[model samples]
Target: METFNLFHDATDVGPDGSEPEGYLCRAARLGPKLGASRLGMSVYDLPPGEAICPYHFEWTDEEWLVVVTGRPTLRTPEGEHRLEPGDVACFPAGPDGAHYVRNDDEAPARVAMVSTKNEFGIAEYPDSDKVGVWAGDAHYMLRRSGHLDYWEGER
Candidate 1:
């Protein structure tokens, strides 16, 4: 068994030093570091006007987000809504689950994201016309229009 404070264990720096532009603060993936293999968990500290991630949805995984502090805007298929502290949102798999979070308040927002961890998964980015394929720890991104035929070059 393992236990730790979410706020205390979280850091402002992500696994890498940087993230997508327009985002402020840092994100930390805690599940892997904590020996959690069946689920994925991450904490994000977002400054005002900063987004936690791009709008996207998974084909093989379901996800949920908990608002730890501050009110953040949740963008979903139904449209955007403000999430207050202690609020929880569920994102089902597939297109209807596509979502993103942004801190539009004056204060910074802290959120905990939890998801099922699958050995293989596919994520689609509607706004970017791109798709992400994940196998084990490897990830590949491709443009939707660049997909090749299934039997291309088959002998």
Candidate 2:
């Protein structure tokens, strides 16, 4: 029986400093640390005027987020909404579920994100015209317009 606390966990910072291109803010990957296999979970601490991740949606996995503390703005396909502590948001698989969390308030915001872990998944970034393909432990990102013909160089 192993137990842990989200608040006491060390913050995981990105290699590129604050406001990384793809994913910004500091987070704690609690899922794998807690031995979770079917689900992915992370605790994020987002600073003011920064987004946790880019605006994107998964093609095969569903994701949900809980506002743990402070007010964070949720950007969705509809529009942006302010989220309060304990507020929950669900993003279904596909373009309709595209979302991004931004801390627009004066203070930092804490959020917990949980998602269905699929062996294979594709994610699209509508704002960046890029796509991410994930297969097992391997992942790749490519621009939407960078596709090549299947038989382009087969001969």
Candidate 3:
């Protein structure tokens, strides 16, 4: 088993430049082996009006959030809901799982996020029709029209 202290690894930078004020703690990351690894977990501390994730969906992985401290507004296609401590939200693999967490309370909000790592996750900025894939240090755009097309028959 591995152990980590959030205070020792937290950062005010968002992996893809979502928010400059929120802090994230990456509990785990890639190991020596290849293929899909677990990104252990993340704790996002967002002050009022900040959010996690830029309203996107994953193509190959799932994510879950657990409210650890203050309340946050969970924005989903179904609408928005205020989640308080002990509340848990899950974004299963698929279009319906698209969601983001925004701190709406006056106090700082904290949530724990767990997801699989190193997989190609197709994220779509719905209103912008801008699709991106988290591949290493950068996010590559997949034109809106080509959001789902892919090689079918094996060569």
Best by lDDT: 1
TM-score of each: 0.90, 0.88, 0.71
Best-to-worst TM-score order: 1, 2, 3
Query: Candidate 1: misplaced stretches above 4 Å?
Result: 15-18
| Per-residue alpha-carbon lDDT of candidate 3 for residues 19-98, written as tens digits (9 for 90 to 100) | 35543322233132124356546667676777775687776778888887888988889999999989988888778988
Ranking by lDDT: 1, 2, 3
TM-score of candidate 2 on Cα atoms, chains taken together: 0.88
Between prediction 1 and prediction 2, the one with superior lDDT is: 1
* Clash totals, every prediction: 0, 0, 0
- Candidate 3 Cα errors over 4 Å, as ranges: 5-36, 136-138, 145-155
Candidate 2: segments with Cα more than 4 A from true spot: 6-10, 13-24
The lDDT for every candidate, in the order shown, is 0.87, 0.86, 0.69
What lDDT does model 3 reach? Answer: 0.69
- Candidate 1 positional error at 152, Å: 2.0
Candidate 2, residue 103: the lDDT equals 91
Alpha carbon lDDT of residue 54, candidate 3? 69
